[model samples]
Target: MNYLKEYNELTAICPKTYIKYSEPMENHTFIQTGGIADIYIKPKHINDVQKIIRYAKMNEIPLTVLGFGTNVIIRDKGIRGIVMNLEYLNDITVNENEIIAGCGASIIDVSRTALKHSLSGLEFACGIPGSVGGALVMNAGAYGGEISYVLKNAKAITLSGDILVLNESEFEFGYRKSIFQKENYIILEATFQLINSDPAEIREKMDTFTALREEKQPLEYPSCGSVFKRPPNHFAGKLISDSGLQGTRVGGAEVSKKHAGFIVNVNHATSTDYLMLIQHVKETVKQNFDINLETEVKIIGEE
Candidate 1:
């Protein structure tokens, strides 16, 4: 929709920043399989983020804010309008047991910060590959800890450029869901409360979780980590494995042999390949058993 013209207008407001026309989504995503975006921008400042959002809202242009890519699939035909990436907002600071983290800060980095300072609560997140904002938006958790438990509050910018400080309860977090998912809110920074612990203990815990993830998950391949959420009492991986879908391939997208839950890009897989492979596995599992596997990963963009 003449994104070039819109991009020119945007640069007039927020100049001297990273902006790209027809930027490849594959370069931004973890799975490395997506189409070109009409306009992709990485705002340098919070005011820049606000200005972009306000501009999009004022002009009735579509806007999609993204963090460090994980747990999302951008479709093969690409996304329309502006794709605002928050990767450059990364900053992290510690204040005793409280950690102030920018939306773009990696969850792993936060965990490491906790370890560095002998904080304990973030040890469970040592293996996650999401940014702070993405984790907050999704309530991302691992090894029995979720963002809801540790989050004190978050600074978010509304679509109209108003700032809102959301408390933990406002997050409405549950099983990979949060208010940010339902509302037009862009996370700016997150405050988390952790606990003091022995440095050795924290390091040991982080190391253990890291080793476990490396051992069980298909870390060697390019893929969305876990394709499906655990349904009821059944584990997603066990269900896929029991359905005999392990090592199943669809145009270079293969259900991981090591971990059935992962769909890896074994070859130069397309977005269609991943989506098709996910559908095939879902159908097979549903056919073999009665359970319908709901995807944990968010799929976006167009066909």
Candidate 2:
């Protein structure tokens, strides 16, 4: 793809410090295996983001949005047109019982802030590895709690550069899904409603959750957390384990020995390795239990 014209137009919108051509996806993703993006930029502010959206739309460039490089797999062929990494928009503020954070703010940071303010709602996110926008978009949850419980509202921008604010009801949250998934909108910020609690108690709860994650998850290896979602009445990990697929390896990608839920980069794993392992696990589990396993991780980019 010829990106020279688009590059010039986008560069005019933001400083050179925020723009790059052919940025490596390996450097941004958690699993660390993918090709380069034709154009990548980190918008320093929301206005800059709006400018880029307008520019991309005006130029007819395919635009992709990235958060903190967690919970996604970009293919070997990488991405075309423009890719915007929202990491620079990291900002968090607390006003009484509400905590407001930018799309790029790390969930860990948000959880820490919650602990500082003796907030109880974000305890479920202490161990989550993605950004605020990602958590809201995927309806991320753990330890019997999910984002839908605390998220009061979210602000997002559309493909055509129109900004919209969605309340809880419009969020359409349901088991790892939000309206953001169904619409082409880029999340800008999220407001979470938390309750007052003893700081000591909040800290204890966070510590317990962290310990559990360490014990059950394959934290030692680079991975895209859980590979599949929980089936209607059964757990994905238990299903894979029951099928004797734990510790299974394909290229460098393996169903984690520590937890069958995660597919880890045990060696020099490529995106293809991860994809193959996922397909193999799905097929194997389907044949064994007559139930199809659906992936929870979002896979994107070209082949």
Candidate 3:
């Protein structure tokens, strides 16, 4: 494609710090079920990200940002445009009882850092399989704690190429949603406020949460963590379980027996298979419970 040619030319002129022409979305996502991206770029620094965004905007080329890919599903037809990966932006620093983390930094890393510093609030994120940026954008949560509770502020690049810092209130975080969902902003970093606690106690809390996840989740399979958002006053998993959709399969994708909330790639599932399963689950739940199940996982690219 001409776009691929343009992407190559641009990467050739860019600094060596960034890597260009990566691979399939499956390689990056937790579910391992997506097609290839035409042109994948990994920006080593924040400036590199800005430059790439400018280039794409100037040329009217499509651009998509990928974090750790824990909560996203790229389509089987593959992504047509530049896929910007911020994996190299991973950086974390702790001051007092707060943490400053780059968007690319893993949530697991942030939680471990908090544990090292005896910070208590982030223990709930230790088991979450996402990067800081993805968590912030989705307001990712587990075990009753969420990003909005601890996030102080965030730095993001606007679609028009302006960098802005927004406080937690400005993001308007609510139940697996954030302002980033509405605005085409690229998150750069976030700061979080934590609480002082004993190191041993923090470790114990993290361990308990991790153990709970291990016992309850299908950690053995490749899958997006939670397929559906929790419906009002009710759990998505309970609804699916009540609908008799547990262990349901479409191709190699199946509703996880261990956790009804997850749709796992049990045996080399294609992206189409996974998506079909997701649709079936949603339809079944709606038909049986009369509650519409919204997806927590972001679906991207074409069919």
lDDT of each: 0.90, 0.91, 0.87
For all predictions, the C-alpha RMSD in Å is: 0.9, 1.0, 1.3
Backbone clash pairs for candidate 3 read: none
TM-scores for all predictions:
0.98, 0.98, 0.96
How do the residues 202-291 of candidate 1 rate in per-residue lDDT, one tens digit apiece? 888888888999999999999878999989988999999999989999998999999999999999999999999899988988898988
Cα-based lDDT at residue 65, candidate 1: 85
Cα-based RMSD of candidate 2: 1.0
Error of 3 at 43 (Å): 0.3
Q: Which residues of candidate 3, in runs, are more than 4 Å off?
A: none
**Regarding TM-score, does 1 or 3 come out ahead?**
1
Clashing pairs in 2: none
Q: Any runs in candidate 1 off by more than 4 Å, and if so which?
A: none
